[model samples]
Target chain A: MLYLDLTLQGLIQGSMYALIAVGLTLVYGLLRILHVAHAGLFTLGAYIAVTVTNAAGSLLLAALVAVPLVGLAGMAIYRLLYEPILHRPPFVALIASIGLFICMEEGFRLVFGPYGNSFDLSPVEGSVQLGALSLQTVEAATIVAAFGLLGALAVFAGRTRIGVAWRATVTDPEMAQSFGIDTVKVRYLNFFIGSALAAVAGVLVALLNNFVEPTMGSVPSYKMLAIIVLGGLGNVKGTLVASLALGVMESFGTIYAGHIMDRDAIAFLFLVAVLMVRPQGLFGKA
Target chain B: MGAYELSLLTLIGINVLLALSLNLITGFCGQISLGHAAFYGVGAYTAAMLTKAGIGFAPALVAGAAGAALLGLIVGIASLRVRADFLAITTMGVGFLFLGVVRQQEWLGGELGISQISESGLGETGFLLLVLGLAAGVFAISLYIKRSWMGFAFDSIADDEDTARTVGIDVARYKLVAFALGTAIAGVAGGLYAHYARIIVPDAFGFTVSISILAMVVVGGIGSTVGVLIAAVLLTLMPELFRFINDYKLLLYGGLLLLTMRFSPAGLAGLARLGWTAGRKAERRPA
Candidate 1:
């Protein structure tokens, strides 16, 4: 029964990780730079959602408004900060992203105050039983919403014209440009989609935990970095698999190792081990 | 000078050492380590623990450097197969791992951290002098390395590892050496900081400190020892001078970093070189 409970919990967490990791992987695929500020955007999305929910008194409406707003903010950040240095060394863009992260994080603290705000979505108020196991309404909703979003994204990327253009830009921007694809527009679209995905993950996380704070994104962002690496950088399928594996391992490892093997340490150990054995990542192509 | 002013000078010296150490790796060797503060923390904890165990201050400092260098060597070896972005993320993971370990261990004082450390019996002036002396020694060593054959190998590796390898330079060994050297100095700086502050917390050595050190190296001009030194001093003192707008300090830092990278990627040193050449051209034309 305990094992069953843990597995279900892990699956829920894994779905959230998958959402965040996939968004990060997409951005990396297109830009070849780690979007460190994506974490700040995650926090921003949650805060925005909470504010909107408080003002309007509807979780669905708050998410609907916040996701697109954060997505636009992501595009604006790319234009203002990253576009100019796109030609520079990758690290330059990374540093700029770090700077952006600091600005956003501190800005949120100044505006929203340092205290954690209750998400107050008041999600379904109770738990449900299934045979020998039980699950919260929020958890079930998160898993369903995560899969729904992922499924939608997979279809969009695999079938839609703009999505095909995004994949082409990722695979070979120069060739795609020669083929008359507006590489710049595709890049902007990529940022919007990726940021929207992150915002969705952020909203789900806030809803699950029932709280949001400026610093909430820091650890999760780093964990997402580990997930993307473990799943293989820029590999969406790999990210999903890796996120689930990581979530399960973390759940089991923490239980077995008592107090020492914390979630961050387990993720870090997995990262180091994977990096040492297969630097290209488990699913990454050489 | 007053004790307060001397303490500030001591801080500048410590930051200068940190910037110089990061400059050695990121600027000279072209390795982007986002976990430099992990080494800094290692040095601090090692020194603090050793001194608490009845070891002499000097010996504890040396032990701290050795400990940090050992960890750096391990990380460097692990990072050999990885490239730029992977290396950055790996080092970041290592940094977080260090914090996690320190936070969980009760012997390391856990979250409260090791405090009430015994002083080095050296007054503020003595500590300042020691820091200045060490800073000077590091600068001199850095200058020597810049002019030596080792510098050529490092430059080659930084410019193009494949070409450097083809040229018979041992890239891996050189990179490991660079990591050891950089981290050893960071360790030294950490030891000094622990003794000076008499309190060491894992929080002090988080990602923000690493970024601040990286900022110093970048703003000073990577590979320019003098430039890094000056920038370190400026950045450390600038916050104290602008106490009124303390809340927005990090925001300002972020803005400065963005502007500097966008406008002058080579940093202050590159700008100074441009000015020097332009002045010379004007002088020659007038003559």
Candidate 2:
């Protein structure tokens, strides 16, 4: 039962990881840029959610407000920060992303006063029970939200014309452009969707913790890098699988090795260990 | 010089060493390591422990460099398999792991960190002079490498790894050498830093420091050693130039890095070339 409880907890946590990593995978597929500031967007989403919820006194209203803004911010980052250097070594794009992330972190500290914010109006303390399993209202909502949105993403990618155009762009940008696929719009769409997912994850994390801080996105930002690698770079399905797997590993690691190292240390150990093993197909570049 | 001014100069000297160290790897070797601070921290802790154990400052700095070189070799082994973006993230993970270990271990002083880190006993001006001397030595060494055969190998590898390999250049060995040498220099800087302040904390070696050093290398013009040195000196002294800059250090560093990379990918070196070309064209024109 304890094991089951941990697995459940891990899955709920993994849903958020999946949300963030999926966004990262999308951007990497499209531009190979790594989109590091996506973490900043996650932090931004949490800040916006908390600020709006506090002012308006509603959670749904907060999500509605935060998601689109984050998505648009994502497009802006790509256009303003990445577009110029896209032709240079991929490392240049990465460095710029890091700078943007650093700027955003400090900007948050300056504007938000560096401490943290909590939900003033707490949601109902409800629990969901399912056949010898139980979950908090926050956990249940997070899981349901992840599934609903990721499922919608899958359907959109598989069925829609823009979605096909996106896949084409990812496979080969120049070829897709030659085919009149409008790869630039596809790039913006990629950022929009990916950043929106990150925003969703950020809001869920804020709700789960009931607090948001400037450095909230720091750990997850790097962990998603590990996930992208573990999923094999640019491989969506692999990323999804890796996210859940990492969440479970982290849950167990925190329980077992928590005394030996911090949660982050344990998680990064998994990254090192994964890189060392280099299991053939699982981590093969997409 | 006054004590305050001497200390500030010494601090800038250490930062120059760090930027030069990063320049060797990221600039010369074309390897991206987002977690270079781990090596810096390793050097700091190693020197601090040894100096506190009654070892001479010189030997402790040597030991610190050696310890960091060993860790670099280990990380470089990982880099043997991965390249480009994957390599960057892997190095970053290593950086995070270092911070976590330091924070958790009681002997590392955990969160409070180590204080009263034994000094080098070289008085104010003397210590500053020693640091400046070491910085100059590293600069000379960098210049030598830039003109040496190894530089060619590194350039080839950086330009294209598979092509370098096809040309019978040993990519793996050069990459490891860059990693080892670069990290050893960073370790030396870290050791100098520990004694300069006579206090050591994990926060001082966080991701921000790594990025700041990187900013120096990028903004200075990647492979251009002189530009990097100048940028390091300037960036170190920036907070002193503007009081508000101290509060927004990362923002300033991040902003400089972003704008520099976006506008001029080759950084100051690229800009200088542009100006030089324009001047030459004007001279050759019907003016």
Best by DockQ: 2
Residue pairs with colliding backbones in model 1 are: none
Q: Which residue pairs clash in candidate 2?
A: none
Per-residue lDDT for A64-116 in model 1, tens only?
A: 99899989988998898888888888888877777778778778888998898
A25-131 in candidate 2: lDDT tens per residue?
88887888887888999999999999999999888899999999999999999888888788888999998898888889988898997999898877546888898
- Candidate 1 TM-score, true structure as reference: 0.96
lDDT of 1 by residue, B116-230 (tens): 8878778789999999999989989888888899888889988888999999999999999999999999999999999999999888998888878888888899889999999
Model 1, residue A97: distance off in Å is 1.0
Q: Model 1: how far is A231 from its true place, Å? A: 1.5
Kindly list the per-residue Cα lDDT of model 2 for residues B251-271, writing each as its tens digit. 899999889988887888788
Question: DockQ numbers for every candidate?
Answer: 0.64, 0.73
TM-score of each model, in listed order = 0.96, 0.97
Angstrom error of the Cα, residue B118, model 1: value is 1.5
Cα deviation in Å at residue B121, candidate 1? 2.1
